[model samples]
Target: MKRIIISGCNGKMGKKISSCIRERNDCTVVAGIDKNPESFDGFPVFAAPAECPVQADVLIDFSHPSALASLLAYCVDKKLPAVIATTGLSNEQIEQIKECSKQVPLFFSFNMSLGVNLLAQLAKKAAAVLGDQFDIEIIEKHHNQKIDAPSGTALMLADAVSSVLKEEPQYVYDRHAVRKKRSKNEIGIHAVRGGTIVGEHEILFAGHDEMLTLSHTAMSKEIFATGSINAAIFLCGKSAGLYDMGDIV
Candidate 1:
């Protein structure tokens, strides 16, 4: 069995991942790290990674971005492969993750849902086929407790479309701030937060008289949790490198 350590063991995604692990017989959670570190589950939870005595084959992090530095250090020091599912990381932190991947296996993804990543692929193909004539807009919805605006998956979808366009599309987060007509080469991304909505992303491609929309809705957190668990399993024996959902799917 693959022994795993969970970072942010007290968070929503963390707990969901724990549940996913329990449902499987091929892996076990040896320890968990969280700021609150209360033992809600049978596994031992420590306030910090350094304090955890359990040895693990891989690490799965679903924590806040603020905890990234310490988690990375722990993983690197222990030579543990990591599956990072946290969103809203800054550019510098992302660069740090890339740098650390050189020393240990790292799996990172904007959205852990397989369907969402597939949506990104479809969006890219639609953008390539539609060309510059169509206007692109992305709308994303999440729970109010989500700290980041314009969920990372929104940006991922935008990147997918921008990668194939003739002119690199400009990301427009807000149109109200600018008093001007929408540019032909701009991709608009809007965010909605309310209630306990799991997640929703819609990509709209609007042409002169018609609109084509591609959307994905996440009804539960289990999709991401299951994906992360799979990622951890996939990373177990891999060489040092940066990996994503594309590698798994």
Candidate 2:
């Protein structure tokens, strides 16, 4: 059986993943690390990975980006493979993950839903076929408590579209009076945060006389937990490398 260490064990997603893992016969949670250090269903909680008692086959992080450095450092020092589910990482933090990938297998992404992964692939195909002739736009919605804007999944979708178009798309989050018209080379990203929205994303392709939209909405956090667990399972015993949901799919 694969032993897993869950980071951010006290948070909603972490708790959901913890419960999900217990139902699975192939793997189980060995430990949980969170700033809260509170027990969830009797599992001991550590303030940090360094303090955790168990040696895990994989570490799944759903913590904040602010804590990423220390977590990655711990994993690197221990040579433990990890999956990073947290979003809002700066370019520097991303670079650190890439650097750490040389020492331990790392799988990271903003969204873990299988549908989102498939949407990225489909968007790439559409962008490649349509070229610059089509205008692309991404809009996302989440809960009001979410601190990040233009949700990371939106940026990921935008990046996939940009890669196929051969140009880095400039992101425009807000528009006011006197704003210039949209650029053909730009992909607009809009975000809405309100209510208890689990998650929602829509990608639009607009042409002169036609339009197409690809969308994905998350009904619950359990999907993400399940996907993260799947990623952790896939990363076990793997060599050092940077990977995402696409690699596993």
Candidate 3:
């Protein structure tokens, strides 16, 4: 059995993961940490990482970005393996995560949907083969409550496309203020936020006389929660290093 500590226990995703883990006989949630004191399946909730009573084998974090630095510091101090599902981390924070990877296993990704990861790979391949023949664009939609525009997953897709193209694609978020012509080398990204959308992303490749599109839509949040648990299972007994979905999938 794998012992687990769930951070951000009060959030929607955290609670879902807690419930999912509790149903399993092969794994157990030993503790939950969150800013708000609340009950999760009759488990004690700690206000901070320092207050947890038992040492956990792994720490799974889906908390806010503001809390990531502190949580990572705690993980490194304890040398606890972690699976981070939180988004909105800056470039510098990402570098910090990479550094901490040397101390403990760390897994991070923009989206936990296995399909999305596959989509990223496909986009990269299409970009590489198509070369400069096609214009790529990424569009993503999520719940209005989500604070970040052009969700992290979209950027990951853009990065994949850019990396394979051998040229940087200018990311154009919005072009409403002034009239402008579409540049041949730009990869446009449009974000739509509205009414309880679980998550949706589409990647479009437009070429002369032809259009090809690849898309992934998350039907429910359970997919992400379930995927996270799967990642946790894969991380057990793994060596210390930075890892991603590709490592497990």
Candidate 4:
């Protein structure tokens, strides 16, 4: 059985993952670390990883980016593998993650949904086939409570498309502010936030008289929770390295 420790145990995604684990028999949450470390779901909750006494085979983090430093320290000190699902991290923090991965197995992804990553793969293919004939635009929607604009998944999709293109395309987040014609080598990304949208991303390829759109809609948070759990299982017994959903999926 995989003994897991959940970071951000009090958050929405944490609770969701905990619930999903309860339904499975192969793994269990040995402990949890959260700022508001109230024992809500039978597992012992600590305010920080240093305070936790229980040992775990792996750690799954869905907390804020600010918590990354302490969490990385704990993981490195304990020689624990980690699956990081937190989004909107800075370049420096990402570099830190890469550095820490040298000491421990680290799995990180902007979006945990398998469908989203598959969408990225499909977008890459479309961009390669269509070449410069089609204009590309990405539209992403999430809940209002989301603090980050142009969800990380949106950028992931954009990056996938950009990677396959002959010439790297510029990412244009807003066109309304700039009263100019769209550039041929630009990828437009738009964001929509309202209600309780789980997550939605649409990639549009527009040509002279036709448009091809690839989209993925997450109806609930279970997709991410389940994906994270799967990632934890995949990371177990793996060597120290930086991993992502592509490694598993």
Candidate 5:
């Protein structure tokens, strides 16, 4: 059976993953790392990564960006494979993940749902076929508690669409101050935060006379929990490297 350690075990996503793993027979959580050291139902919870004592086959993190340093350090020190599901990471934190991946197998993704990744792939295909005639835009909605704007998934979709376009594309986050109209080479991204939105993303391809839209909606946190678990399982026994949803699919 695969052994797992959950970081942020007390958080919403962490608890959800723990519950999901309970229904499975192939793996079990050996320990947990959270800000609060209080004992969880089935596993011992440590205040920090360095304080954790149990050995596990994989580490799954759904914690804050602030936890990346210690989390990656612990993974490197133990040569443990990790599945990181945390979003809203800065570019520097991303670089840190890349650096750490050189020493340990790391699976990192902005969004873990299979549907979202599929949407990205479809968007790429659409961009390629539509070419310069289509003007692209992305809009994402999350809970009010969410701190970041535009969302990581929105950026991921934008990247996917732009990667296949013939001409270079520029990202336009906000237009409140910019008095000019939308540019031909611009990919506009917008964010909305409101009451308890699980997650919603829409990719709009506007052309001269028609529009094409691809969208994904996350109904609950369970889908992400399931995806992360799959990633953890896939990372087991793998060589040290950076992996994402593309690698899993």
Candidate 6:
């Protein structure tokens, strides 16, 4: 059985993962670290990573971006494999995570849903085949409680499409202020946040006299939790390196 430590055990995704893991027998959550440090079920919750004494096969983080530094420190110090699901991280923090991966197995992704990653892959392919003939646009929706706009998954999809393009395409987040015509070389990304819409992403490839749209809609959060758990299991016994959904999917 794989032993796991859950960072941000009290948060929404944290609690969701904890609940899902309970249904499985191959892995168990040994301990948790959370800012609230409230007792969750029978496991101990630490106010910070330094206070957690329980050792595990891997750590899964779905906490705030602010908790990244300490969590990574603990993981690197103990050479623990980690699956990071937190979003809204800055560029510097991403670099930090990559650096820590050199010492321990680390998995990070903008979105944990396998469908979303698959959508990203499809968008890249569509962009490559359509070439300069299509005008690309991305639309993503999430629950309003989410703090980030445009969603990290949106950027990941855009980046995937840009990778196959001949030139770096301009990313346009908003066009309300500028009353200019849409440029063919730019990819428009729009974010919608409201109610409890789980998550949704749609990529549009608009060409002359034709429109091609690919989308992925998340019906529930369980998909992400399950994906994270699977990633944790995959990381166990793996060598120190950076891994993403692609590694397992």
Candidate 6 vs. true structure, TM-score: 0.98
Clashes of each: 0, 0, 0, 0, 0, 0
For model 6, residues 58-142, the per-residue Cα lDDT tens digits are 9999999999999999999888999999999999999999999999989999999888888888888899999599999999999
lDDT of 2 at 126: 92
List the global CA lDDT of all models: 0.93, 0.90, 0.87, 0.95, 0.94, 0.92
Question: In candidate 2, which residue pairs clash?
Answer: none
Compose the digit string of candidate 2's lDDT tens values, residues 107-185: 9987989889999999999989885788888999999999989888999998888887877777777766327988887
State the TM-score for model 3: 0.96
Rank ordering of all candidates by lDDT, starting from the highest: 4, 5, 1, 6, 2, 3
> What global local distance difference test value does model 4 have?
0.95
Best by lDDT: 4
lDDT tens digits, residue span 133-249, model 5: 988989999999999888999999999998998787999998887899888998999999999999999999999999999999999999999999999999999999999999877
The TM-score of predicted model 1 comes to 0.98
Query: What's model 6's lDDT at 38?
Result: 88
Clashing pairs in 4: none
Error of 6 at 100 (Å): 0.9
Clashes in predicted model 3:
0
Question: TM-scores of all models?
Answer: 0.98, 0.97, 0.96, 0.98, 0.98, 0.98
Local lDDT at 143 for model 1: 92
Tens-place lDDT per residue, model 1, 1-249, is 999999998998899999989999999999999999899989999998889879899999999899899989988999999999989999899999999999999999999999999999899899999958899999999999888898999999999889999998889998999899998989999999999999999999999999999999999999999999999999999999999998866
- Model 6, position 82, has a per-residue lDDT of 96
Candidate 3 per-residue lDDT over residues 137-207, each given as its tens digit? 89999998999988999999999899987677788988785388888778999999999999999999999
